[model samples]
Target: MKPDLPTDLTWPHTSINNNAHRVGFWILAHLTHDPAYMEKVREEIDAAYLTQGPSAEPDMGLLLCDCPQLDAIWHETMWLYNTASAIRKATRACAVGGKRVSVGDQVMATFRQFHLNRELFGGDAGAFRPARFLDDKSLARRKGYAPFGGGHTYCPGRLFAQREIYLFVAETLRRFYLELVGGAEGTMMPGVDRNTPSAAAMGPERDVEVVLSVQKL
Candidate 1:
């Protein structure tokens, strides 16, 4: 199970820690499924290493992390596989559409739903494309692509989370080339099973598994 981000929680730390192996595995899976993306990342990493050397690792410094392209991949993944899909209300209130609301209102926003919104992210939004965020202004104006959240209730530990995510991904990519296993296609959808065990805030039922290979880079 992965630790999900909350509108109020700081970072996806649990999600990052508990699901690191899972996330790492899926990263490999996606790379295998799309060799092109893998090649692009490899090229960037290679170039960075050429100038700064491999010792200038992502977890070590802000060197490679300043790369926009690398950041995009992290954003896309968070969108596609947010840890939690539901947000519970603490008080009664009126909804935006003039609808009456109440305390304990269970509002759910699946990561897949928002992440794949075609209006916000164009051209096969369902498909994972890191290059989509290359245009800084456009990416900013996308409006609804909030993998973390907005406002004062915004995620507190976002900086920490981003650092961990970027570091983890950069290190994983730097160490090994990835590929999917058992000919599986990546699926970022949730499952249903109320009886399942959960270690985080996410519901007891959520299926997130992607098997992939990790070969020496």
Candidate 2:
């Protein structure tokens, strides 16, 4: 008999950690590279914490809920740059999209595919536009766009991860002014073949080295 334990218990721990880093890095890269977007993000942050001084920490609950703009940024960032792929086994035979799926057949759901669907994301699916998500939260509900997966197989720590990332970002912005050095442009390059276990959820399979100056207030 098989043990009653999750096959990949450590998967969630690593996945959540890497995802949080990815989100934070993407936010930093995107904002610093684009003046317009950076200003928007700064404006939202400034407005939300206008009453609080730099020394005082902004309430996490307020930061999480009050700033729709920031939330939109998080959603858009995840939609565009997410690297998570969910592999699920069909419980019963079913036909989907003109293809028949048998019980126990493995189905891989990739976030990149779903998030880039022109039907749901429009012709400029490749563009970095936060308004797309901010305009309508429903856009995030489109099928196959599972940043943290979905339904029964959804990530258990999705909410906790989001809060963790939001707090990291908010607190960082609160304490330091981060600006990129050498002006590394934020663009999505095609991913290359990799032998890592988390390859499917990796963006570009490479890193752009950028120096950032974080000055404390």
Candidate 3:
């Protein structure tokens, strides 16, 4: 079960209030683009008994948000799409291994490098394969994939955000069908250069787009 938060601490007031939509969008984009993962997600959702009344068999509201499988999907998506570099300030002036180090030295950890590291992620880290997380050994190797930051400064809203994204994607797929319009493809994938702007305040730009048709399934 997911931890409960105070109602007063509701979103828009939370750390991720403003960025939730953007984050959720990226999560769905990755899922929709990867046929294998998408199929799995749909299959799981389909297994839940459907109902026409307010009370459904699976209580999809909870399944889409708090389910383990859905959360895993969100975690994988974040690991693959982390674009922001983590920054830390050094504490206490000191020398490390004879090298002089000063207090407050700005340190940047570009997680993107490690996230895409083939040595750590296997032969083809660039590939979007959620199955990598299904294996206990492989998932254990991803201990350093901290897209939500770490330590005392870690994001408290991480769990909430993941839940939100899961529900959003599930409901979207269950509802209307989405289709990429003509010419949308040309505008989909943008340059990924450092100079290129992100889809969000800190998201990386990628070159790819797929039109979708949203009809009832």
* Runs of candidate 1 exceeding 4 Å displacement: 1-13, 18-22, 50-66, 83-93, 102-112, 135-137, 179-217
lDDT of 3 by residue, 1-217 (tens): 9899677865336346445665666656666555566666766664553663333345566565445555566656667766646677779887655977689887766676777888877787766566677664356345567776666757777667656666677666665444333475543523334674432223435534555565444
Please estimate how well model 1 matches the true structure, expressed as its whole-model Cα lDDT.
Answer: 0.55
lDDT of each: 0.55, 0.70, 0.59
Could you tell me the TM-score of candidate 1?
Answer: 0.61
Ranked candidates (lDDT, high to low): 2, 3, 1
lDDT string for model 2 (1-217, tens) is: 9779887767777776556787776766666566576666666666666466557666667777778777887888887776677788999999888999999999877778878889867999868888888777787677766787777877788888888888777777666665544433324332422545452244445654545556545
Clashes of 2: 1
Clashes of each: 3, 1, 13
Worst 10 residues of 3 by lDDT: 196-205
Error of 3 at 177 (Å): 2.4
Displacement of the residue 63 alpha carbon in candidate 2, Å: 0.7
lDDT of 1 by residue, 1-217 (tens): 9788466643455655544444444454555556687777766655555345445543234434556656666655655545444465646665845766677776655445666778867767877666677765467446676655555546666677656655666666766655433323234333323464433222314334444355544
Cα lDDT, model 2, residue 88: 85
Which structure among the candidates has the greatest lDDT?
Answer: 2
